[model samples]
Target chain A: MSLSIFLITLAFIILLQAAIPFLLKRSIAFGVTIPEQHMKERALSSYKRFYSATILITGTLALTVYLLWAKNRTLSEDQVVFAGLAIQFGVLFLSMIMYLYFHVKTTKLKRTHKWGAGLKQVRIADLASHAKDEMLPSYMFALPALITAGLLVYTASQYSQLPAMIPTHWDIAGQPDAFSRKTPFSTISLLLILLVIQGMMFGINVMTKRSGIKLTSAKKKASQIQQLAFRKYSSWFLFLTTVLITILFGFIQLVIIQGGMGNAAFMAAMPLGFLLIMLIVTAIYAFRVGQGGSRIKVTVEDEEAMETAFVDDDQYWKAGIFYVNKNDPSIFVEKRFGVGWSINFGNPIGYIFLLVSILLIVLISFFS
Target chain B: MLIQIETSSDIPIYTQLSNQLIELIARGQLKGGDVLPSVRSLASDLGVNMHTVNKSYHELESKGIIRIVPKSGAVINPSIRDGISDEHRLRIVEELKPIIAEAIVLGMTAKEIQHLASSILSDMKEE
Candidate 1:
């Protein structure tokens, strides 16, 4: 439960995930149109390679840390090292399962349209129609990572005060401390939450991909559900953590006032201040994430008429002539209709900037 | 001669290729009876689907612009001496009438429209 180990694991996962998009981009650059049948195969194969490399490196590092911490230490007969290993293995298995599920779902969607049919004449209008469908599964694929990260954070915190070796006692009722009292419950809760989140994300992915435009109406309902979930989780976390910190602070103040102005108060206050700052930062980030979720661009074009329209739900920007006027065929009828293309906040450049910023932050964290 | 195909353009690849060939012929850049690349060879060279190049050759052949010989290659056809038939001319004029009306609607006077047409024709002749 060392802080360094947790940070190292986080760094490994983020770096590996970041490289996935870059690899896909490289394949596209090489003029290899990953055919529908092979898209998942190629992606999974690449992911396996990345996962193996990461596991090998991180596993060695973790083993070294364990050896250093638990040197010459022997656990009692009931003490088990297998619980942590089981959780890690379970998370990995679930990630693979989620990946396969999405791959199959996206493959099925592509097959329904037939090979090359959608891309053959590929008008801008076709892209507009297909954008929503294509993007739906991406969020699903991201679900496993989100679930795993959440589970890991919860597990880390729950097991933070545990010694390097597990205790021999099996009875929670006879345990000496609160940490030992709820150990089994905490572990079981973590696993169940992971499973539920992963399953829900997969279900949402499949349902949305199948429902397509029907999901747009459902999306509004889903958003309300999501907001509720956010509020529920954040408030619960804040309330519990706030209570725990306040109690800890009160204990420190009692000791400090008795001992007469000492370092204990500063130590207690430091973490409280740090927690408040983290909550504020997380709130800002969550707001930005919500803002980014709602908008998507749609490109429309007519190849025959040589016209193009870039539209979203709220606004439409069209360029080129839709038709030559019958009364004035000699004069081309053109309309450059859009509120303001430049003013649109949700452009491709913004996505690129966000991606780069995330990468920069992850890299900086690694070095730090 | 190499004819590039722009797949992402609004115009179909076949039409683009055919137009380029026609323009080359009209400018005497490709002379009558000159040999052209085989469809498969041209398609491979241009990194296009073979069917695309085949369609372009077919369109050119149908228009009497190029003659395709089996296993030999395509060759430019001799220019036609006679002008379009009276029926065809009338059909073209019928299509132009609406365009003329459109020009009038766009604030072009009849004389101005006529002048513009003549100038375009003269420019084409120079090409």
Candidate 2:
């Protein structure tokens, strides 16, 4: 396969990634979850219009760029790949901007009507008594780490068998494109990557756990249960991902030494497999439980206690997304209407953490 | 030691915290010398402002229900009647006056009012 083939696949992957978030956002229309039931239709219509317009503009821009690039046969494969990637990414960036814009509008509309405005913050009595239940799922990452270690030993056992130059990069059609020296680092780089990914996922899991839940007074118990469920579900998701990555990378390592780079058909399918798994899981949970998993109907259906349940407290959210509450000391809190956790921008520690995280990411990028 | 507070209640958050702490203390759920959580930690747990938690702690301290040892955590004070000054007695009566008046206005019979307070006591015991 040529560079063009890889580029095409990458563009498609990016497009799908963008669409998944949009799909979750679309669930608000069903009133099965989010911003309470009454105001959902309004949000739905406004968001639908916003999304449609953004998609139209983004598609046109991408298609124009692709056609323009198609007509120019002088461009090298690298240029074609670069052009395709840029077009897809540009579309994503534009759509995100539009998404935030509409989010701000919806937030303002929610505020105007005073939706969920009367719900009080629920406080836990004897905070220390029940705090032990919020245990970190660190063991989840450990499982993958242990698997990687086992694989590392297996790879090292074949140290004498690996070729002088091992295949490092593959083409879309499963052909080796770039080669690297068969040193421990080169042969084991895939494992190292897996380890780094595991660490990042674990860190995120811990951070999300620390991010406190947001719930109203009447629904405090139900909300707490939901938050715990969501956390449990997320950790399991992380663990599953680690196991999958371990198997994939472990297989890749074995294939490189055992069957040769040309035999690595799995390499081409790995990305597609990962994306499919992630999309399927996300779709199932997001639809079933909704954002923060707060609207989950399973145990949260206590009728008498749900009078104050969860209100769409989107008013305090700056731009209808970033929660800004000076009174809240938590650095992180579950997002009001999104699937993931959001930082409490109102807290100084949150800004510091965000800055540090960005710096760490930059350093990692440079070192890697 | 469960202390639940409602933020939107007309009652202040600190009052809610203090009232629940008092209830726990009275019910023996919080025994003498039982250490309460630090202001910062409690605030973080409940997602409330530090001052709000501090206020609650201070309120408990002022009532002689808890002792805030310097550099140490707040501890429940032994509920000994060291001697009730007339002013303290008056204050207690003043606190109870509103409840009695509200119950009377609601047309609750004296026996029913007693039953209501007893039900609350019984419920607190269950927790």
**Whose DockQ is greatest here?**
2
Listed in order, the DockQ scores are 0.02, 0.43
| List of clashing residue pairs for candidate 1 | A125-A301, A327-B102, A328-B102, A329-B102
Candidate 1 lDDT: 0.41
Candidate 2 deviant stretches above 4 angstroms: A1-87, A110-136, A151-166, A180-190, A255-262, A303-316, A324-331, A345-368, B1-12, B24-45, B50-127
lDDT of 1 by residue, B1-127 (tens): 3343444568887788778788777766677887776664444334345687789888888766788887678988887678876875787799789999999899999889889988866765685
Clashing pairs in 2: A125-B3
lDDT of residue B67 for candidate 1: 88
Interface RMSD of 1: 17.4
Question: lDDT score, residue A146, model 1?
Answer: 51
Candidate 1 chain A minimal-lDDT segment of 10 residues: A332-341
DockQ of 2: 0.43
The digit string of per-residue lDDT tens for model 2 on A123-175 reads 56345533544545676667778878888898899889778988876776566
Candidate 1 per-residue lDDT over residues A233-330, each given as its tens digit: 33333333333444443433233223333354454345445455555544443333221122122232222321121111111111110221121111
Error of 2 at A92 (Å): 3.0
